[model samples]
Target: MKPGALTPQDAMARAVAFFEHLEPAHLAALDLIYAPDARFKDPFNEVQGLRAIGAVFEHMFATLDAPHFVVTGRVLQGSTCFLTWDFCFQMRRFKRGQQQVVRGASQLVFDEAGRIALHRDYWDAAEELYEKLPLLGGLMRWLKRRARS
Candidate 1:
């Protein structure tokens, strides 16, 4: 497939489908969604290829409970599809630890095959995640309130 021939709507749909399959542990389907040499970037990891991509998901699933992606909105132009997504899940740093829910969005660029070539996420790590953790949440919230005033 050629990049020029791919429609934005089609690309968006494919991207959504990929996320839909991601829920409830569908590691096997990753190969179908990501290209062999695809590159993925997030706050914590910079990975290349399907194997590395799969490892990212694997780490998430291992650490987080009920991890899922909710597609809130999508915009497509040329080969780039900007997706507003909420990745919500309960995560704990260790067993018997308190769980926290984290949310974020990603802007993705697709190739001719509708596979993601570049995925960049946008969200405030301090506000959305770190601020919500147990001990850190209290300190972060206090800082935020002080800053606002």
Candidate 2:
């Protein structure tokens, strides 16, 4: 079914399905949710088009052991839908023996066609990511604890 034909709830459902189907080895589902010229931005990446967006996901999957997107909530207004997502993944830094789980949220905007036109993520990079990395994680946690005390 075409994205535009689906209701807001259906559209959100489709997006969820896309995420669920996304695997570390393949990325064909992105073509279903993001417009061909969609603009996606985050702490590490700022780019347009599905190819670039797919690359971001590819990189994450490559670096992380198991990466996935969990949609927590969604709001629709007119032709736009704001989606709250929790991106979860496990990454190993510098040949570490184990992987670490990293999570973040994103606010997504969809076009009338139900394709993601813009995706702006909202999360603390220092706390969620930088603080999870090997060396930086130690420094960040130290500073955080020091500030709190």
Candidate 3:
């Protein structure tokens, strides 16, 4: 089927599949999944354009070890789709050998061409990631404890 023929859910599924084993070479083909003007945002970065979006993934590959995403749930409404996923990876420098998992969700909006126009990821960096580190984890955990009733 043509790209434009895909429903929003199909497009979201394709993106999910593509990210499961994301590699640097996949960045070059992002245009097939994302529109040229696509805007993407997550806890650490916010960028526009497919090239910039590709840069984020490139940086991810450079800074992490075997980073990948597994979609766990999907909900579709009109031209928008929400996907709950588990982001798995190992820190390249810190705690270098253990696998880490961050639970999160993404909101995606598809353009007329069925390419993703907006992709925003939602997750708590402190809770899902920072608290998993060795040094920062202690401080973050202490902070969390102090804030609780």
Candidate 4:
């Protein structure tokens, strides 16, 4: 790690902490960590530009209850980093306050400034999200079983 520069580990750590403590107030602060034209993608949506990225997080807080990310592991290689995380939260519209955990990972690409250029998340939406819901959960589980050989 250099003296004043943001190393890959430092960036990952900062991101982990940021997500763990993220609130609606810190949406603007994303500009500090992500490039202006950054690309962010997950299983459900793909967005480019920091404002669009911020809107994603904003929607998360608006739609979920106390949503947070717990980073379990990190691997850094060159300008790309992979972070395994546990997304823990409760559904605001369904399942009430019961805790739900979605295990997933993210691929982060950093530029010369150490700000994220691309943030891609990989997870099984059917298993991690839909299968945890009430009505959808049952159908998802059934579909999973049907799809299995």
Candidate 5:
């Protein structure tokens, strides 16, 4: 290991900090944490490259109000780190006054330069998101009940 090279633990910490303190203005600093051609995937989005990834966040900010992440746990092995977090926000349209929480986990793979090369988030949209909506909530709950029986 080089003396001045960034360590995996360091990179993990940076990623966590970036998320916890993230704001609309911080979007420009994503390059500091992610590789140029990094890939990002979640339930609704699958995108490669920093620009596309940033676009996802931009849309998030535009649609949600006061969105933020709270990391509850983390596990680091080699250059890969897994983080469990709660995404909190208020919907701009439905349930505009109520705060929503979506618990999820993300697997991040860091490059040699200590930048995230890949980020994949895992979460159930039906349970976390769809079930909270006005019209969709009823259908989502019904489906869950039927599946459980």
Candidate 6:
């Protein structure tokens, strides 16, 4: 309990606020909520360190239009938290104006210092993303239809 030290509760609140209010400018301040060597993994990328993690977010901003997260639910226990959210964005390449939503969840583990040590995202790339693409959408639908019971 030192001056300016964050408790786990504070860190969780900060993490949620950081994500919900994230903007390009906030990219420079990730260290406030993440450990220097925090690991972030998703269906498409796995990266460690603040710089690398920031790059992943940067890439998202670069490739997608109006990308944002809407937190739906959360569960917290000890140093871990699970957050379910909807990732909404417009595909810059294909569906330019239409907003796409991908339901996902993130498991965050915080360090003793209250900074996120690990962030792993769980989501189905095929059903959530690929099924919305151009040529791939049709193929994915067909494959799903064939697999259904």
Best by TM-score: 5
Better of 1 and 6 by TM-score: 6
- Order of candidate numbers by TM-score, starting with the best: 5, 6, 3, 4, 1, 2
Q: Name the weakest run of 10 consecutive residues (lDDT summed) in model 5.
A: 1-10
As a whole number from 0 to 100, the lDDT of residue 61 in candidate 5 is: 94
Candidate 6's TM-score: 0.96
Candidate 2: TM-score? Answer: 0.80
Q: Which stretches of candidate 2 lie over 4 Å from their true place?
A: 1-4, 24-26, 94-99
lDDT, candidate 2, 1-149, per-residue tens:
35336666666677767765688555776767887898989888999998899998888777776677777777767656666667765565563555444455555666666777888777778987788677888999999999999
How high is the lDDT of residue 24 in model 3?
87
Span of 10 residues, lowest total lDDT, candidate 1: 93-102
Model 1 lDDT tens row, 1-149: 66454465777787787785586357777766676788898778899998888888888888787677878887777777777777767665643345444566787887777777888787788987877677988999999999999
Off by over 4 Å in 4: 1-5
Candidate 1 Cα RMSD (Å) = 3.1
Per-residue alpha-carbon lDDT of candidate 4 for residues 1-149, written as tens digits (9 for 90 to 100): 44565887778778778877888998878888898999999997899999899989988888989899888998999879999999998888878989999999999998777889999999999888888877888999999999995
Give the candidate order by descending lDDT. Answer: 5, 6, 3, 4, 1, 2
Model 5 has an lDDT value of 0.94
Taking all chains together, each candidate's TM-score versus the true structure is 0.83, 0.80, 0.94, 0.92, 0.97, 0.96
Candidate 5: misplaced stretches above 4 Å? 1-4
CA error at residue 67 for candidate 5, angstroms: 0.2
Better of 1 and 2 by TM-score: 1
**Local distance difference test, per candidate?**
0.76, 0.73, 0.89, 0.88, 0.94, 0.90
Residue 93 shift from truth in candidate 5, angstroms: 0.3
Q: Which ten residues in a row have the lowest lDDT in candidate 3?
A: 1-10
lDDT of 6 by residue, 1-149 (tens): 55666776787788888888888999998898889999999998999999999999999899999989988888889889899999999988886899899999999998878889999999999999999988999999999999995
